[model samples]
Target: MERMEHTSNADLRAAADTVLARLVGDVSGTARLREDQWRAIEALVADRRRALVVQRTGWGKSAVYFVATSLLRAQGSGPTVIVSPLLALMRNQVEAAARAGIHARTINSSNTEEWEDVQDEIAAGAVDVLLVSPERLNNPDFRDQVLPRLAAATGLLVVDEAHCISDWGHDFRPDYRRLRTMLADLPPGVPVLATTATANARVTADVAEQLGTGGSSDALVLRGPLDRDSLSLGVLRLSDAAHRMAWLAEHLDELPGSGIIYTLTVAAAEEVTAFLRQRGHTVASYTGKTENADRQQAEEDLLANKVKALVATSALGMGFDKPDLGFVVHLGSPSSPIAYYQQVGRAGRGVEHAEVLLLPGKEDEAIWEYFASLAFPSEELVRRTLDILAHAEKPLSLPALEPLVELRRSRLESMLKVLDVDGAVKRVKGGWIATGQPWTYDAERYAWVARQRKAEQRAMREYASTTDCRMEFLQRQLDDEAAKPCGRCDNCAGPRFTADMSEEALDAARVDLGRAGVDVEPRRMWPTGLPAIGVDLKGRLPAGEQAAPGRALGRLSDIGWGNRLRPMLAAQAPDGPVPDDVAKAVVGVLADWAKGPGGWAGGVQDPQPRPVGVVIVASRTRPQLIHSLGARIAEVGRLPLLGAVEYTGEVYPGPRSNSAQRLKALDGALTVPPALASALAEAQGPVLLVDDYTETGWTLAVAARMLRRSGAQGVLPLVLAVQG
Candidate 1:
């Protein structure tokens, strides 16, 4: 690489002009690069130095990499490798690269079939930029077969949404840590760039240190003020979820242009989207659960202005580009101000002014706490996972390992990636293998990370209730030295929105939210490798023993009744009798459940007999709630109240383990009392099994099986709330 001092200023100026012209056509016009953008481009292309650019959204961060790639490719360098985080963002980057006459391609989860073709293009020197997801870096085949060649031949490397590489980042992804290995493998003088709009001083330092680009002081860090001049921020404290949904239905069209409405959960997004559509708004729902095809269509529709807005979760955040987005409304507050600022930055990129509002709900903090529980695993769990893999005779796939370990599938996958990066495990063609490398759990580091999360949560609460300027508060949270009141927020200016909702709208929202019942489909097959846990069950369960399809009053994660049931079912809440309203709601669900297609009245090939009696499942935690709910249902339906199923063993509660372990714990925990067996023997129809809450549904399945064997015609599992 040539030193910057040796290059003449005239040549550098001429090269920058050409790159700018490619970036924006008709360069003869006032289409020149900002000083910071030029500096970043010079560092990466001419000086051959690593750079970290922490500019706000729409500050031309992407332009620096695209232009640099164009210049580098002209000099016969290999294709630029960009690590992006979202599919929507990748699509937009591909299109933007095309406008500059650069050939770009992406290899992500959605396009595995195209990986071979992309590799061919790269080898043939026909590709200028190649985009990939962070998760792909840890994939066994890609890591072993493709990463080495790409790293050795890459011209420029870019990490978009680079904040995720830091543990202190609001959205940390373990897979991003794999970059450490890639960075080390790169040849000398290969320029690297990382860009994010949401990182504060701490996150910036952390990411820069991880980049390890000739040490932190040598790496060029260009961080600008974290403020969007076009966004007018505000917060409205809504009474509850219903009021929030009603407000959106009432005021969605009053905002500037088509934009995004972000929700904290997928269920809330779907509910809000449905309610808005009922009120005559053309919108779509976007979440992690959405299929790839549908997500693509939703993005295209939003970009084309075919819809008014997209009701989405954080799944739609980061890298989505739409210059003319008009507004951003949060149905619920995010856990961190950095995350909030990132989502709100999506608006007012091209336009002069846009609306950004946060409708804080009472349940927001609870939702935040629930997500906080999914952080990195404990030392014991990690050790257990490693021990399992080490003792196995052969490599263990994720499912096979799930039975031996207690972590859920998603969390387990994330932990494995972290271990793989730490050299404790290796992912091969068959499965994961223990490397037997000595590793120490970083207790102090994890504790610090936990404390940081709590502080971020506190900052978010402050952001919601602060009387200061919203933008200034958010900027200060990111450690922006230039933080100052924007003079446009609700605090600086007067209130921009009102909480007053008409009775008709409120009534409509209540009806929509109150109409609750979610089908709880029974588990039809036993988890694989059950015999390894000393359980006899395996393969498909017999049809005769399967529980009938069940119903729940609502999901614990829903936007409507969830708010009502969460507190009552909270781990800390005192156990008591079922509330009158909830009991009434259960009756409503039963009434609707009886009329559905597969209900007792439905004309099916095998019609189920109506439940003749009600049986309560004994609960150690919420015995009163379960017993009261069952007794009320029996009283209302005029049915016999059968004796309760006794929990004969120690109070195992419910599934805190994987399927195999949970089934093992619940195999013979329940027993039919003599009176209950006698009552079931004389029953003429199916019986309803009641419980307080259902999480894994293994408890319900076991109890239903016991009831069926005791001579009940069939068993119907009913619960107050179902875990999402």
Candidate 2:
């Protein structure tokens, strides 16, 4: 087989056209590559060049790579290695490749059992394309052994969702920077292609520079207008979550076809799913918590249109393709307009018209702030981490480091990935180790990045409230030179959606959101490596000391009551008596608990005992609120109000991100007062232990242990909200 580099331009064009028709399932020569698509392919295959393609969604970005892989493999090129970002995207690409007679195999978190077989196929030249996730690029064995061989033999390199390679991109991942090394190691003359639909000018320039690695400093960048004529974009602003949900219930059926309903958090997704199901709508919840098999099933259900919509989070954003997906409805605004664009772009791909709507919520900003707090740790935290690793005797796994650090597991791993890329640390077989490299914190750059995020958030707010063309607003956000009004949008053609909801729908939504009580599952096991932090605790907590399964009025992430509960539990909110409505809601929750499954009414094997008293957990920030809730419940249930458990020590000053650190701070801070102990001894029945809210549940666990040990029959914990 000869290299196509010397092929005539006309011959290259004709060959690409044949592959394009086959890829699109049009065998009668009715389908051809767009001029820009052909140019991208020609540059990659004929000229052996690196190229960055910034095209709109549904603009045949995948086609460019599939067609190029077909042409390159025919010329005896090694199997094309694509560094894809999402499992969904990889699955879609694999199927699409097979349609063009390209044997594509994926190695992702979901397909570990098939990795060796896939590798064997690649080695035997039976596989024409191999798709690996960005995270896979950093796996110890894969990085140390497999990547080098794959790089040397690769004919073409493709980075799907390439915007993620840029720090400026909306969905940047630290693992993406590892691509620079992969690109640098590629054999000379290996053509590379990067594609995304959501990059702006800044992200585009950054990605182009990244693609220029390994001496290809003049990478070709092909960007196109981002306007989508098939989309009818609109924003329907209602008063609160209930109204927005009511609007959804009233209008979901009216949307063009089967599609997605995006929520900001997993709790919201599940809540929406449950409520929509109760209303007889065919919907399923898809989130990070969903099992892999369930996610796959949900995706299949959506593709087959077995369900009307999938209530999902950003977890379902990338790699999903349903050509006839008729709509995409966002229940809450995403923090960045760029991310919103990528999500809404899922619709209107193959159809003449599709509906895209945003039902922005007031709780959206709070959710945004919560995620923002998890960004790159401060310089102090990073320095401390480096010092700990510098003095370590061996590679430390993430759990081993958790007790020594203040960051959560996800944030900590993400930081390690960045540090690994920055040469300050290295990920080895066991875990992470310090490289002893001279590393300076990029304070200025991080500050600029923070500012950029805030600006993007503000832009998203404007997008929701702006009177201008919605499509044009998104286009300009991507820095498209051809941004213009799409006359199909609600703004351009006048409002196509009404904010008004039927009274019946509104009442039903209120009933759903108004009903409270999410189970507060007890923490069964203590965090790992607690001894490293001077704590002797480890392994599963004793059943005798564990609190009975508790209940919260709602979650801070709940779409129904989150808006009402968030403020009442906020650190800055004025602490006062529990409002009458809230007090009544608590009573209702108790009544339901007394009668629901596993309640004291004897529905389960061993039903809980009715509370003989109410006990308050001391709250430094909201003692009045806690006391009021306990007193109200005690009065309503005709039970005694036991004395409050008191705080005996100063506030434990530590980051509250992970369970271990949280437990460490709470270890000795709480104590059962003598009066409370006496009251508990006399009560002789399960007591309703109360608090304003529970975040980690460790505090509740600690308090419940003290109560149970002090002779309380059992601790039935209740709280205003669950922050997890």
Candidate 3:
């Protein structure tokens, strides 16, 4: 203990070496700190100054923080507080800390039961390092009651994945911006360390500026080249999603080692995982929707090399540490090159050669656009949100406030966090309350953010098409000062992977993709606060008034039949008769629907009757398609073609807004003609309600209600596609 105290103020290099030896155990006998790692440790421990370290994934950024924490604690400083963004990261850090003879603990969403014990450890000075997620910084109980004490006593502050602290970053989180308050309140001498593997010049500058204690000049920034020698980057332009899947099915075993297969959506992740399983590959699906216990199991499986891969979304990103991951493959391109770089960096961390492949698809841009729409809300919407809270009599939780605001639930939560950072609102025991503080909406800043996102999207497209070195392209995108062409990537050294799949594999993939039929579950409950929107409906719809579980030929976002259905249902497609092939596919779907697990053949005591008649929903844009489909279905089934439900009001033009607004627009838009009502009154069984596509399902719900009121036994929705 005496020797450790003496070494704290001695030569900083010697102290860092001592700590590094403890950090790496016997490995440190042959290992030495990189010059920049030593510099960051010195800045934090010796100089007691803030620093930001931007290096590639395997560059020992964690060593800088762990070494600094050891030095500070040896001198009797308080515990280090690490603000990490992911649970997987925190768990890995805790385990890593234990190897250095440091006692570490974490408080996060996953372990509320342990929080009290953790707090007791902190109070007892038994915890050497403490890690908490960024969201925990804004949690009402932690922020109001515990954060102040932790901030003042923190020996060192480390922000992992610090790119998230800047809005300029591709994956920014509003919760991270709340760190400004924590940074401001920290005791004067507590040093700060921020680290990330992915950040361009703009994001680095933004984060460095935020790290400023008294002035911007106080923060030292250390950035290095973003090249990963172990990763051989390549891009394969697939004809469509099915081709991408076929390529994977044909070549997955050829990849080097156990690794990750990334998909852009949870559904795609699950679909790909299922397909690979069918192909006899061991894989698991990981996504935001994955259960916590399952996520832990998946991570464990990947680390143990039990599964060949985990088909995952970005939820498996950042903070997952595996030293020898073999490869990374993307089913579709991400919207930003920086984000793609971060994900691929997860690979080749502790190996000689790991493959990185991107299979760009045509639907990638549309998916990008859909996500881009969820950026910070407009000033009008933000202002309206605050007004609602201000006028409320009590704190309002997210779901309780969701209907009052037109923004979606996720977007609304993000906006509330931003407002919390701006001091316009506060999250309390029950929910959020207006702080009654004046705030200004930064219109220029938001516009600049939007423009930045658009630029990133464009850069991603260039990345997919560029004829240059893929590694160099990614390095340059991150503004790496020493960016250079690697001699290993596909472009720099010619193609290392072939874009060929066996005809047998292609046939199997085609059959898989061609197999279609997605159950469209009826909207069971009405959106809450419908009365506020001037709709008489509220709560769950009665069983008699609801549409039965319906069927769509395919999901508009699916990788399968969606490719064929998209153009046909697109707004610009000219209305025409149902094509023969699509008609045949629909018939196949109906046949399977009658026998599938969730359908009438599921062995229910009471079976559903077959459709006795067909009713076409009025369509202004695709009248020819709807009428043709209804007529063809009736002809095929030998059923009566009931008169079409006529549009009694102005055309709805199909939901361009939220659910409430959509319902309002289509409230009285359709009515059953007297002939149709009379025919329905005479029908002995269910009738088929046909439309080109269903977006919100509110139209089907409303139409079904009318049919049921007209004495039809039941209404079954049959549509070409369902939009997600």
Worst 10 residues of 3 by lDDT: 1-10
Model 3 sits at a Cα RMSD from the real structure of 2.2
Clash pairs detected, candidate 1: none
Evaluate model 3: give its lDDT: 0.87
| TM-scores of all candidate predictions against the true structure | 0.97, 0.98, 0.95
Clashes of each: 0, 1, 0
Clashes of 3: 0
| Cα lDDT computed for each candidate against the true fold | 0.88, 0.89, 0.87
lDDT of 2 by residue, 60-131 (tens): 999998888888987888989999888888888888887788889988888899999988988898988899
Worst lDDT 10-window in candidate 1: 1-10
Badly placed stretches (over 4 Å) of model 1 are 1-9, 25-29, 214-217, 602-606
Displacement of the residue 353 alpha carbon in candidate 1, Å:
0.5
RMSD of each: 2.2, 1.6, 2.2
